[model samples]
Target: MSSHHLVAVDWGTSSLRGALLDADGRVREEQSHPRGILSVKPGGFTEVFETLFGDWMRPLGTRCLISGMAGSKQGWVEAPYCPCPAGLSEVRAKVLEIEPGRISIVPGLNDSHDGVPDVMRGEEVQIFGAMALTGLRDGLFVLPGTHNKWARVKNGMVTGFRTFMTGELYSLLSQHSILARTLDTSAPLDEAAFLQGVTQSDNGQGLLHNAFGARTLALFDRMPTRELASYLSGILIGEELRTQSVHAAVDVVLIGSPALTQRYQLALQAAGTQARTLGAEATWAGLHAIHSTSHRKT
Candidate 1:
């Protein structure tokens, strides 16, 4: 591992990004492309990777660790999920080596809720990275995206987690549904309106009933069209929060983009919970940690 460099990649559905890291696990360079797995033709991953990252891999002994959809059945190569209760060591053990020591894919994690199955690909890396950065072996973590995830970790391992379609639902209701008629989707965040929706969600009427209020509020001019989008966003996110047992005494770690995390932070505050945030750096640290551990074992 002394002379070798690492190429850390996070290839998801809509885009791909990578970093060139030195032996010490510090990022030396970074780049991204809009060509995500969905955009690549079948069996064309090699071509795409080479086109986007060949220069970084040209140096001898450089290894690449790819995470996310790039390892899914629809991507370059299928890396089976590593079942939950997984830690860094468990994940490292299950990595699918595609080119011996030159490249490998980090397997995603699979968990179950009741009888329904839930899976996450790249979020596992971010969770581990958050742990590495925060020095907390156990806590609750939330990753907000198209599909928001709420994960619980104990003793440095993910015991289980749940997923919510909060973001997708917000998009649908705000853009595709009848509510879109009055929504100013491009309006900036209206904190007051958003919080109003959050509060409305806890009214015991449930989401199906609460969501419709967004349209009615706008129709009757009770709420401004410009703020309707934020209101709708709050209702969905607030519903997601309703499923969790957030305690004021406990802190939740949030890993995602600023916009999403900021919303989660505000919602959590309303629930009397504290939140800490980590961004893309968590993914890099998680990849580097696994790469370093795997190399040290050899």
Candidate 2:
């Protein structure tokens, strides 16, 4: 590892991940904390962050680059989303200010048309990293998360994208809604039930209409709660797959955790859209890409 050091963070609503990388961009050390945005409360980020990084700071003199919800309206500070076709400099200039450290915040991107708005945060870094790796000028990139995003890359820029709250809605209904009463969170992913829901979801059955099937199926005792939960999972994912305009002619890369990528790959396979796992080292990949550009420019 190079002697010089920098930090990269992917902070979300529920958890925060940070990496200490060498000047050459290899991760030397990393840490995570429960001081996610939700847990930090309003204006408590400095204290919470200090608790997480106080020890590491003794090593000293490391600059930081952050992505994800950390730049959102509710995060530590609003770094503001840059419009599409933005460059590395435009993103870098929006970095939020912090004391006692050199920290840069990567901004989100937004596009609106026909009274509908599509937005993204952490995925932009992955997209930039993917372009650097693949040398692809245009393709489809999918980032699966609480708010799954499907993006269209054109001429090495994010020309357009859409967000589907598939994971978030699943969590909401599964935990807080009546569906929770009828669904089992600890249940395994039932391939059979998953396939059934995937198939049904494709047959012109609208998502809202199909959502009722979960409870209805349970009401008649035709589906077990575990199976129902699995089916619901398949339903939302499948519906998103069916409706989205994925550019399959160019390569489609999926960036996310292994299980999420696998589940999406299975669903895309069922929908006849091919996508490959792009690895789960998003923060590292993003950090390396940013640091490389930072070096080139300097």
Candidate 3:
């Protein structure tokens, strides 16, 4: 049997994160790199890993468990997705071994709701980690990012979920679209303007019409020139919460960076909803949990 530690990875589209864990599953060291799946040359994943962790693993070769885009088709290896309402055991059973059971990739979750398929990778681990850490039996869990995810969880398992491209759209419209010219990108959010957008989402006017309001608001000087971006962002996030929160329990679990979560918490509050923010390092906790239970030979 090997005495090496476990290395947990959260390799997403734009970044790669590695954590070296001791036997007790506590992270002893952590490393992050910008070499995401999209940036790595085709079939060069091995080289990239060596560049990032070779020296760290030199002391004692570590068994690795990877999640996120690293398991997608575009990633190092395509670990097949497990169908939802899935638990960790099911996800674990499908973990793909990249090196004779030594290096493994965690499988993402897939759901077909109303014939529309959706999936999430790294978030699965974080969501389950929050579940294990908080001991919450059921609620709505949100992971805010480029593609915001809203998941329905029950009894420590993910029942179903949906994804929204609100962040991506904001970037596109704020940076490259015509609206980009009318607003200051670096301007801080105007809470009043943002809340106004949140309020507008419920006016029965649909997103299409309301999105246009970003332009109209600035055109008419209805909102401050510097605050246009914030108001726009609010509109998108506000609408996302409005539509999805209805399917959620009274209290929603909001996850992600503090800045983003705070915005969500406020939006949630405005929507007459309650949210509990989990400040733990969810992905690491999740990977640690999986590694603890796997107990596979190195």
Q: In TM-score terms, which candidate is top?
A: 1
Candidate 2 lDDT: 0.78
Give all TM-scores, in the order shown: 0.98, 0.89, 0.93
- Cα RMSD (Å) per model? 1.2, 2.4, 2.2
Q: How high a TM-score does candidate 2 get?
A: 0.89
Q: Between prediction 2 and prediction 3, which has the larger lDDT? A: 3
lDDT of 3 by residue, 100-141 (tens): 646789999999878999999988898888887777868888
lDDT tens digits by residue: candidate 2, 125-222:
88877766666767888988899888887777788788889999999988898788889978888888887887888879698888788899999999
What is the descending lDDT order? 1, 3, 2
What is candidate 1's local distance difference test score? Answer: 0.91
CA lDDT of every candidate: 0.91, 0.78, 0.83
TM-score of 1: 0.98
The clash count for each model shown is 0, 0, 0
Worst 10 residues of 1 by lDDT: 243-252
Quick one: how many clashes does candidate 2 have?
Answer: 0
Question: Which stretches in model 3 have alpha-carbon errors above 4 Å?
Answer: 1-4, 59-61, 245-249, 296-298
Q: Model 2 Cα displacement at 258 (Å)?
A: 2.1
